[model samples]
Target: MTAPVSRRSGGRAARKAIREAPLTDDVRPIRPGMEGGRYKPLSQEQVEQIHEAALKALETIGLADAPDSGVAYLTGAGAAQGDDGRIRFPRSVVEDALAKACKKITLHGRDPKNDLELWGSRVHYGTAGAAVHMVDVNGREYRDSTVQDLHDAARICDQLDNIHFVQRPMVCRDIADNREMDLNTIYACCSGTTKHIGTSFTEPDYVPPALEMLHMIAGGEEAWRARPFVSNSNCFVVPPMKFATEACQVMENCIEGGMPVLLLSAGMAGATTPSTIAGAIVQATAECLAGLVYVNAVKPGHPAIFGTWPFGLDLRSGAMTGGSGEQALLSAGCAQMHKHYGLPGGAVGGITDAKLPDMQAGWEAMCSNVMAGLAGLNMVYESAGMHASLLGFCHESLILGDDLIGHAMRCVRGIEVNDVTLALDQIAEVCMGGPGHYLGTDQTLLRMQSDYVYPSLGNRMSPKEWSENDKPDLIENTIARKERILSERSAARFDPLLDAEIRRKFNIHLPA
Candidate 1:
């Protein structure tokens, strides 16, 4: 008689035999560019009222501190400079700029497959922060983030299916000089991943050197301009309506250099802006509208995201409360305003006040992310791996966020009520003729992989099995996954010749 087959070996063979086929783009349940707008927190009238208020603010209150060049650009485009030294945009000018703005833009990635189309209410999640600290999960302590940490974060984002782009999420404390820091930030992110990157420059002068390194990576300056893989996340507005002088100059340079710009207006409620939610939105909208005029004045119809990232504050303590419900509503409201103008927009979401990636972090992250997606935000920033109200970044938390964003995208996809999905016949067959369940049915098997999302680290084991399997810890398991990925991932997709040229030309900090 044959020796009895071992249960463990038999189980492995059975699992291998039943493994599902590979998935294709057509069958992917969730993906970048999925339309949102299913959740509308503001009525149409309310949106229009806010728009009117914003226009009034721009035409009346105006913006202060526009550089001489900016004043010239704005005045040439029908904006008036008052005797008080403020630049006032005529309502007509603002409207014209909005009409001429690039309604749909493609954020090109160094890898063509990672390109993101920004139009409609399509939602794309990605990393965005300037977190200075790195959370040491094992030690449960925070330390200054380094260039290595930035590169590692990019690499992690490159592999995560749900994170569509890799923006500079942390600053490199190792690089001392400001100019050096800017250039190295570019190198580290590009070398780490080919996804579309968002980086900021300290001054206008730093941009050119950074572009040269990018040119070498892109094969030439002309190629880099054609499919410029990086965008300038310019915080053009200081707050409650004033131009950040240096940032405005940087914006001008980026526009002239053929790079996309995110016209960022990050006003904080109850502090820099009005305490009321609607009032905060009005201020942010007015500020971003001025940004639109600035961009079009510089170069009409140029690529820019209508970025209105107004943050919330704790009224009691006057501290920023990024994870609060008020912050979520603020972001969602801004998304609605973006939809109103039919311009590509970006907003902040998925931030957590919790210092660690525990249950508190989970609830806070999911709340903002779900609302951002449902509100039809085109680009949702800070959607992963941010902690302690954006002061810290964690590698393991980034890995876990991939799973969180997957579920959020599923919500954006909503339900399809097609005839096939209704499956009246399948239901009847299961209830009347087939076994009391439909677990092994053809339709069930066909829809399983396409219609469902499985978390990489989430637990689903029954109590008995969990105890038998030693009750794994989510954080520990996620750390293991992070290690496996970093170990198995190939070096950045850079040509050896170009990489060497980049090093010779610039202060490249990342190791070859």
Candidate 2:
């Protein structure tokens, strides 16, 4: 509230604004040992073992056709590239990247540089694939995408403090210009609304627009310098594989400019990668090593995230389904390999083949997301249909996933150690006093939010009360939440002139 034109006798308007309370040093409390969440994290011992496995895979069997520039660094440093295209790396290369990689980064939310921090105990999430799909606030399915849907989705994502970053479309069908709508929409949505964005420059000339937009949110050079632009770099390294010149060039630019990269290699068993988990891990390890070498070569200290996915393809369909159990195993293995490099691990999740959010969605998403989370993925991609090797996206899954992410978060909240939970005397007092009272206490009032995640999509009311208003299920609640969010959401802003300029620069137009 602002001061009144006239002051009251008590000088009520003169009180300095006080903070709500100090922010908890949550990062420290939730490190290494203690457990608290929907599932258990790998023990330190397990993490060590996985890391070792990744090292062994990298040194003896490096990675394949990993862009020539990347291979030059590795093989030049004791790696071996076989005729088969698999360039096996030495343990030293993995150690080198990890040595140079900034393990912890704060990926700023409002300013790309001020936002996110990795390498701490903080768990982060984001998506990297394209041709997006979106859901409006009212739970309406908006096929392909429009600037309107883009604005609405960005608004909702902007509102959710839970989600750290917004990847461009969940799937944008507006491919009039090689997913250029995706390019502009991603920039427009993230600029003023949030600091972090998940994107890739589609062409060599395509980078300026996206980078400028990102630079806008980052404020200026000092800010961008501090955070450095970080993004998803799925190093294409499977059957019939090689990185695109544009992809490699953009990646080269990112490293040269000191931006961070997530070197990801995805494949499906038998079709693109070996059918065995170990083979897939080796294959993925090589791919990540290849990417790391390129980054490390250009800018030695650039941050790098290591990852992979060897999801099995349904032989008949020859399509990668997000819900495959193999996805869980692949993600788990990827986590191990990333650890091998002593780099942050990343993977994909919130997957399913239901073509919609239903039981299949729940199962596939729960398994992959939960496993990835528990396995301690530094950053994991969330959303669905990405099944055509992450080429597709479904809207309903995105909504249902909001709830799933909530649960995943709650699972990882960890045990609390505040004044109350520390329970130095209160618990003893309650026990001695005979625990009869259920309420009417200061402590209870102070801890409600911490104790519960009041649901937006769970069954909680009496059937009588529910029926009176016409009972609705979780899906309905999800739909309603979407509607409410869209209706009330304040759309974010962008530089209209700058946007117009970018339109001219790209020579692209939105379709009707």
Candidate 3:
């Protein structure tokens, strides 16, 4: 369904409008367009082999801490579960589950009728599980993030149509007081917009609270699922390297609710995981597959998303190098690995480990994003401004990020052909025997807007025109653009009164 056109220029009366941008590059299908690069695309059969290898890792080595249902199924199906807490299954079991599984699913938004597109040809962008800082209206940082930071980020995200799903960013300030914190964030997303609301909960007791809050905001589980806020429910699957009791509960809730669950595992290469990128890829794959197989095992045919975010260690200080080349390779390889399983693949692009928004951040960020789109990842997260990755977030970075994603959309989309693009008849009609008369044709006028990319930053205006304009740098132009949008548009709200009621129940201070 066509979303409502909400792209008004922000508060700045004279600024140009920021249109609802396209997710994938509208350019593709052209033969040899941005294809056949140093990085090779995996063949369908090659992807299958990784799937088999992943299944073998599960069957032979077996992942530890599989749920009781998983253990029971593996044991019942001629598998072995040693007291060591690892359960090994034969390739047949995994193959059987995948065969019986319907990999295609649409996690419903508040309107079950409203579904996020998945498994399409191009990559769709999303955010990974967690991050700390957030950007405010004036491009300022709110560190250690609070409840207000969370809701506004969600609200800002809700307005940006290019973002496919809203992963629960660190909105709640206090992990210690999750009971009070969860309510504000969950209800804010439920009431603020119709985009998929990624649910947030941690630990055992937090599970009941999260569910209670979701029910409170959404009416109840049946209603919540019916007009489900979360379109695709992907979670952080604790690495074999670490444990969080709450992550497990989160997994359980995802399955029980039948939301699309992606088991996300991130471990550093050479540290928590083996030093090599290949080694980390396999280990991380094993980690997520181990959990996903549980999802399939518990409720046969349940929709599951496949994911991996394996970090690599910096040889220097033994730190988790988030935006390393190893990460890029791992994310691309992760997409291929998941493709092997015939499941939806999820990974990140547009990442930066830079401490600030600068050239290094933009360049490093563009590489991951472009590759992920070229590799055609199913769900690519961390699309916006993520500086130092999980360590920091910058405001201006988000403005720069959408353009990086724009380029990725460009790279993956390739090219499209039509009567206009071919220009065959037009060329013959306009310039058959004369000097180039094609420029004078109505055809050229009709096609200019279609072909040119009106970039947010890379404006190539004439020097005279540029001198005349009040806006100078790209940041000035972007700030003006944002003000125009927030001023002219407000997202679909639940109700001022119901919002007040939710705030009264949750004791949150919402935007007036």
Q: Which candidate number maximizes lDDT?
A: 1
Of the two candidates 2 and 3, the one with more favorable TM-score, higher being better, is 3
Go through the candidates in order and give the C-alpha RMSD of each one to the true structure. Answer: 2.1, 7.8, 7.0
| Model 2 per-residue lDDT at 352 | 65
| lDDT for each residue of candidate 1 in 155-192, tens digit (9 for 90 to 100) | 88888889998889999999999999999898888878
Instruction: Output the TM-score of candidate 2.
Output: 0.77
lDDT score, residue 489, model 2? 34
lDDT (Cα) of model 2:
0.57
Clashes of 3: 21
Ordered list by lDDT, greatest first: 1, 3, 2
| Tens-place lDDT digits, model 2, residues 99-132 | 7766655554554322665553346655445545
Compared with the true structure, model 3 gives a TM-score of: 0.82
lDDT of 3: 0.61
Residue 6: error of model 2 in Å? 43
Task: Score residue 125 of candidate 3 by CA lDDT.
Answer: 68
Top-TM-score candidate index: 1
Question: Over the stretch 1-512, how does candidate 3's per-residue lDDT look in tens digits?
Answer: 98675443232222233222342444322211232122445566755655666667776677666555455755765567767877776767666766766576565566543355555333676554466765443544456766655555565665554565667655465434666665566665665556666655544455555565566557677776665555334444555533234565566666676455666776777777778766677777776766555666667777666768777678788875556776777788777776555566677766677776667887777777777766767777776767776666544566566666666666676666877688788777766775567653576644444454445566666787688885478766666655564454346466577656666665665565
User: Alpha-carbon error at 94 in model 2, in Å?
Assistant: 3.8
